[model samples]
Target: MVMQTDTVLQKMSEDDFMAVFTLGRKLGQGRFGTVFLSVEKSTGREYACKLIEKRKLVTCEDVRDLRREIQIMRHLNANPNVASIRDAYEDSKAVYIVMEFCSGGELFDGIKERGCYTEKEAAKLVRTIVAVVQGFHSLGVMHRDLKPENFLFLHHQEDSPLKIIDFGSSTFFLPGESFRDVVGSPYYVAPEVLQKHYGPEVDIWSAGVILYVLLSGVPPFWAKTEKEIYQEVLHGDLDFSSEPWPVISESAKDLMRRMLDKNPATRIATGEVLSHPWVRINGIAPDKLINS
Candidate 1:
């Protein structure tokens, strides 16, 4: 399924990526790519280089999606909360994208290590996530996939800055525009996305799911199968009557309810979510930890 070398060069750069930077240990891997810790030859500065194999791009659509992702990353390069793309290069075999290296691991791993967080801590995290969503929407982009795994800390410090990664499923949109693609992780996917008609508000729903998981250590909608999970997401009620719920702050729950609203129109927007008392800085969310 490998594309012709000339064709790939037409879409990407013909220059040698290895000549400028040396690839180090493997950082991670995806369907069509492997991310490596790379160092620039001249400066010795470190970066993450995502090397997408041309052979795995089996179809024209796959190639288009990769290009779109690169463009989107470049578009949001100025945002401090986003992983900045430093450069892109391609050879006959692969496309290499150099980006900011996040030393700390995924937000999911961080949460797993901590077991659970206080309402205030969760609120602080959610505020950062929502701010990213708000910024993306302001720039006319919709982050079709918003999940904890896509968020990473800049360093291992407790107060390290959070940055959003993976724009592969993101796309630009106009005000009032609707997208029909059903793109997102199963647990975080909005009900409207399952129905095949949705907009940027889908990101809010996913963020709500993340918030819920952060406070409770589990997703609000859970089932043994993906189909059943979607059913729960579509019809199940929010379980504020559970164990941890009794101890969690009501202000946090109120914001959750509004953000996870099934109706996109009625769902709280990023601006309003940021302004919510529980989410705003020094707001009402308590510092007490929830039961693990």
Candidate 2:
């Protein structure tokens, strides 16, 4: 997928694209796009169509990112954990990206409802996310934004596998390539990202933050404002002396500590994070992965 670069515009030239799908309820909204639950009139199949207006792209980089996201999603759709793009159609004003419709809601909403999870449960969730990260890394793509909201379950089943979504913030990068963009949710951002120099390790850091939030109903660094939260992140002041902290296994905390290290160079890589003892306890490993 990394070696292949397809033209997004080439696949979106169907003149009657809008006539093929009947839009239903809105699923979500973003800076430049609106997702809706739509059905293809020809096949009567359900899909999620993200419609992005060209006029609202803000910058030329936004258009580049849109194309990059389309290419990445199209090429990387072979993995079960990834959300696949079924088709893309463009009109003069906007582009419509039709994707697999995921019925289950965001992983963050689940966390909020549960308030927290046991080590076993949290390990299972983290393993799924790490597996997706590994898959993306193997494709030479880095998900600049890795948060619970970006993870959605396929169904309401208890054992439903999580599907990683929203690649607008993702980009192609070699193993050691450094990215200067300060992208990602503030609460989950790595320290090096704040310093304006980082690589794939930033995703690992975000995974660690998510792990912390999953095991305990609170983030490692939180404050009233985004600026204050970022300051705490840069300071790297982690607290594990509280109630639930005393109950979590040392191995889990150790993994989080390694992932959330201030220096990106020393932080755990996605491969190692997948192999960590905490992540492997859920019966997910290199040989037997959830989404290989």
Question: Evaluated with TM-score, which candidate comes out highest?
Answer: 1
Model 2 residue 254 CA deviation (Å) reads 1.0
TM-scores vs. true structure, each candidate:
0.95, 0.89
The positional error of residue 157 in candidate 1, measured at the CA in angstroms, is 1.3
TM-score of 2: 0.89
**Model 1 segments beyond 4 Å from truth?**
6-14, 112-116
Model 2 stretches astray by more than 4 angstroms: 1-12, 111-116, 282-292
Give the 10-residue window scoring lowest on summed lDDT in candidate 2: 283-292
Q: What is the lDDT of residue 273 in candidate 2?
A: 76
Q: All candidates: CA RMSD in angstroms?
A: 1.6, 5.9
lDDT of prediction 2: 0.81
Model 1, residue 47: distance off in Å is 0.9
TM-score of 1: 0.95
lDDT tens string, model 1, 1-292? 6556545435556558999999999988877788999999999999999998888888878887888888899899999999999988988778899999999899978766777668888899999999999999899998988999899988888888999988889999998888888889999999999999889999999999999999887999999999999999999999999878888877889998999999999999898999999999999999887776
